[model samples]
Target: MPVVLLLDIDDVLVLPVGYKRGIPATLETFTRRLGWEIPLPTEADIEWFEAAGVTSEWDSTAICLAGLLLEAARLDERWIVPDFDEAMDRLAARALDGAQIRPDYVAWVKQAGEATRLGERPSQAALRLWQREVLPQLPRSEALAALLSALLATTHSLSCPTTAVFQTWMVGSRAYEEAYGRPAPVEVPQGLLEQDQPLLTRDGARALTAVWYEGRLAPAFYTSRPSRPPLKEPPPPLPVYSPEAELAARLVRLEDWPPVGLGRLFWLAEAVGLHENPTKPHLIHGMAAFAAAIASVDGIIEIQALQSAYETLQAGELKGPLAEWAEFPWHVVLVEDSVKGILGVFRTVRRLYELGMSVRLTVFGIAPHPGPKAEALEAYVDRLVPSVNDAIEEIVHLCREG
Candidate 1:
């Protein structure tokens, strides 16, 4: 069987510098251009929002919009609830759950989510805001689109052999579909065309099918019961005067790293690789160094409170096409750019393996940031490479060896 190279979009096939730079401005533009009276988040707020996104329970853009709404309401007496802090907490909780926000904010949040999830063209609202508020200021969207197109073409050439048996499916995050654009016939290179046979031929390779995101088909195509795993018990509090606690304290004061919630810190400390402390693994050591660079101004108590709520959030389960894909006799490669992406891929691989599937899983950690608890992942995935091209080369070598 031909190897099925599952790709990731952001930071994997395409550098995410556009996303990293454009998103904040996108959020600000939404508020200003749409007349939503939402207050702009401070740098501290942005850090908190990004940290929350690591959980994957909430879409990062949605959380950004929710934070702005809550902050705006908190500052303006006219928009304030009786219990400002409590209301803000409730909003944060809802955002993490991926619940649609109030109508005024929902359109922008939905648009942003769609851009990331489906790779759909920017919504009118997003485009208008960008043109008016962001385009003149900064131009990253065009570059992002060009990079996405090139990635799609490259993936097609690598995975879809001109003559072969078995199908090639693109299994990835919502953003993975951005290259194909909602499924029209894609033009293959002239060289590939010469060797290509009918897609349905018994001995011919199947044309690439741009379907499945996060292991499920598009929402419109299929619906399944939401997988709600039981919540894990919260980690015990750090002991006062311990080295762990001291390190946690120091992490919160750093100016460069995103503001990790105290609960996340505790979780990180107990997490397999991070728990090793002084004699830490490279990935863990890298995380500690990162945390020191961008410590938050928020106090431990405040972060702990946010962490308490975050703990209650549930992550969606992988099902449908993704699960089915695991059963196929294909070499599966997962490419991701963040610690969260690596961790999620690891969990999926473990689950598939437990189900008695013989999966040859290789993970590519593309341009992953320094911080994040990803050390244990190296053990779960068969191989970890630095880039997509490296991953593709590894896949080719593995197939030849086989």
Candidate 2:
């Protein structure tokens, strides 16, 4: 089959370098629209925000916005008293007393701690106020839609079968449900490309494919509730590689890879190692292969569990059932930016190894000048390029080598 190219959206397709700048503008928009005067975040605040983003602590910008709103409300400390302090202190006491804390309570304490670390203390009252008054009043979904729309407006849009998979801790929160309508399920939009006009705007069409409230796919702290199901069986070992002729014949049968592209096609094809692609119809097929690969484990649908299976395969504890998923693509390409994305890519690489497939992994750093974390990914990925364009060039070079 044609190489399955997996791409990440955040920094890879859409550079979030403007996020720092967007925060102030977003805050201003919120203020003007809501008639609330929220102070703009300073440079130091932006720094902390970005740092927190790298650490995957929270939705830094969202939290920052919440903080600004809390400050704007200027609610009386009386509101902050019993509920905030009492609840927090109760949790603290429970921890000290060796009492098991409720998951919701633990989440609240973590948020409070993060707020404290960020030099903002959001009393439970402030949170309640925001949920009741501010969050609902704000155009949360519209703002997100606008942001994604703006990004797509600037980039080369995908014409092929494409899906957008979003993972946000906020989606699982009651606040999110209260703010937006119930989260959307996994589905493609009808009439997305109708009469040469997309029914929903490009972003809206993509949004239809979004799968949210599945926090098990993201970092642990992001979700308040555990979504992973228990594992049932051990995963099977990797399968032996298909013959070269068999692999080439499979690619010839795929209609998605056009003849023109195939004419210029190098021996290797690109495939993306994605964390989530709930909207992609082929996702079920891939997940089936993944499930077969890890038959012993339950919850293979969860990204975290899928990653653990990949690790087991890597350690040689698991063997290949390559014959089972012989149609799995080879010479794939994967691109990632976030910590979660990188981890997903790592697992994909191991999976490929188990299948006797080769991969060309590209780490498009968050910025032109990435930090140690991005650099550290070099140990795992096959290549580290500055941008997606560079990654394509690298793929071409690899093809020529073969």
The models' CA-based lDDT, in order, is: 0.31, 0.31
Q: RMSD of model 2, in Å? A: 17.7
Candidate that scores best on TM-score:
2
Candidate 2 lDDT by residue in tens digits, 86-141: 42233233222111111122233235334432212223222433455544544442
RMSD of each: 22.6, 17.7
Tens-place lDDT per residue, model 1, 1-402, is: 334343333333333232233334445434433344343444333333333222121133333443344334333323223342343344344333222223233334343433332112122224334345433433243432232222222211222111000001111212122322232122211211112111112111111121221221110100000111112443232211112212222222211222222234334444323322211111222222222211222222323322222221112332333333335454445554444344444544454455554555566654333332234335445555554455544544554453
Model 2: residues with Cα > 4 Å off, grouped in runs: 1-4, 15-25, 29-58, 69-75, 78-324, 327-329, 351-366, 370-383
**Candidate 1, which ten residues in sequence have the lowest lDDT sum?**
218-227
